[model samples]
Target: MPDDDATPRAPRPALADAVHEIERHVAGGGWDGPVRVFALVRTAAALDADPGLADRLPAEAVAAARADAAHLTSVEQEGLPQASSLEDLLARLSWPQTVDGVALVVERVVLPSAAEAAMPADPEEALAYLMAHPDRQDVRIAVGVLRDGGSWCAVRARANDDDAAVAGGADLVPGLVAALATTLE
Candidate 1:
């Protein structure tokens, strides 16, 4: 059997665009924010279900949906219950059939691999250590996964905080991508 991790999945343009869109939207709010989740839905399907929605959605988005059947719209989820960790939040998530996919935006302070050995065991101390580390990097990661197994990720570093500087790929953040994929399952 082929190793799933080794398999390369073709990039889904619509999903990539949706992930990037969510990343940019979250970036607009600046850093030091709570985790945000979004439900991905096919714009055409959403419109067909309720044509009245067009009046509420952005005009450009609606027009794009009409022009391309693959266009996806990201609907931000609100009032999510607080979880001890992101993994716990993801573990508790399950999507409805209507949701084509899911995306999550989260900001994290990352240090170089060398810093891992020096991290404090206490959660609070670890956070403090990370914050005080001279090499620490603040990054916002947006990961999107479709039910069809397509996934995309967008990463924006605080050091190079520019929309055009954002890095994107299918496996940029593989662990997060897999976690998001399980929500669809």
Candidate 2:
């Protein structure tokens, strides 16, 4: 006779596949603006995700990452950095070996310097100017990693015209793959 206490679990995604899915979601949403990313990792979980990474990380970094494992769980919605501050925060980060995966959030505008300079100073005029320029760009996207190294993302773009022009994920954010790689490394 079998016992009654059994629960089937959902299958987890492969780390790489999870990353790709996040990219796909962002692309589908036509995200275009600034991007912010965070990595959520566990040393053991990271090793399971990428065995090759075992050789690349320093012991200290791995220890630090493990110690910070609960960081993501404590983050509240208002606790996230403002979109404008994303770049500054990223510049200061140094990923450790215990990092299992990465998370990102972006809000950006892709406009030529000339266009920015040509905008009107008056609020009404600025609104008019923006309405007249269909090519003006603005996008926002958010990506996050699970403790197991799986990832997910959400995106929204301001204008459909500009949205159709940009690619998703790595193509959308420069240095993204490298930044993500740091965690695994």
Candidate 3:
């Protein structure tokens, strides 16, 4: 039998595509951008509810929606209020029945497990330590979760900096996935 880790796992098609699209859109702006939030709605349902939307959306997207029942349309949420942290932003969010899911895109700097043991307790010192860590990686994670409990994630490292290098899976970032799921509930 093939090693499970070596075997590739496919994420839910609709959610995976939506998450990747959002990741690409965000990546276009380059790095060090603010957190972005998006509302995921079934494309067919949106078009059915508002036929005029078909005219405004891209022709390809409309056509894809007609071809696939599971296609999702991601609407970027703007004018979000400032929050103390990402968790606080998520905590203040609650999707309506019309929204089928939610997605978040955020950039973070991460250090190796070994470096955690030496992290400073003070917030400023911790920030300095992370910045000075030679092994740190800057990554942007896009996580999407549906009301039905399906989740998908896309991670792009600044070093790799290529769409082809972006990784995808259902549980790539479990904590972020769970946080996004709560917004749907």
Best by TM-score: 3
Which 10 residues in a row give candidate 2 its minimum summed lDDT?
A: 1-10
TM-score of 1: 0.92
lDDT of 1 by residue, 38-62 (tens): 9999999999999999999999999
Pairs that collide in candidate 3 are none
Give the alpha-carbon lDDT of every model: 0.91, 0.47, 0.90
Q: Model 3, range 1-108, lDDT digits (tens) per residue?
A: 111352223456999999999999999999999999999999999999999999999999999899997899999999997899999999999989999989999999
Please give each candidate's TM-score: 0.92, 0.39, 0.93
**In each prediction, how many residue pairs overlap at the backbone (N, C-alpha, C within less than 3 A)?**
0, 12, 0
lDDT of 2: 0.47
RMSD of each: 2.3, 15.2, 4.7
Summarize candidate 2's per-residue lDDT along 92-138 as a digit string, tens digits. 55445554456665665555678878899998998788767757767
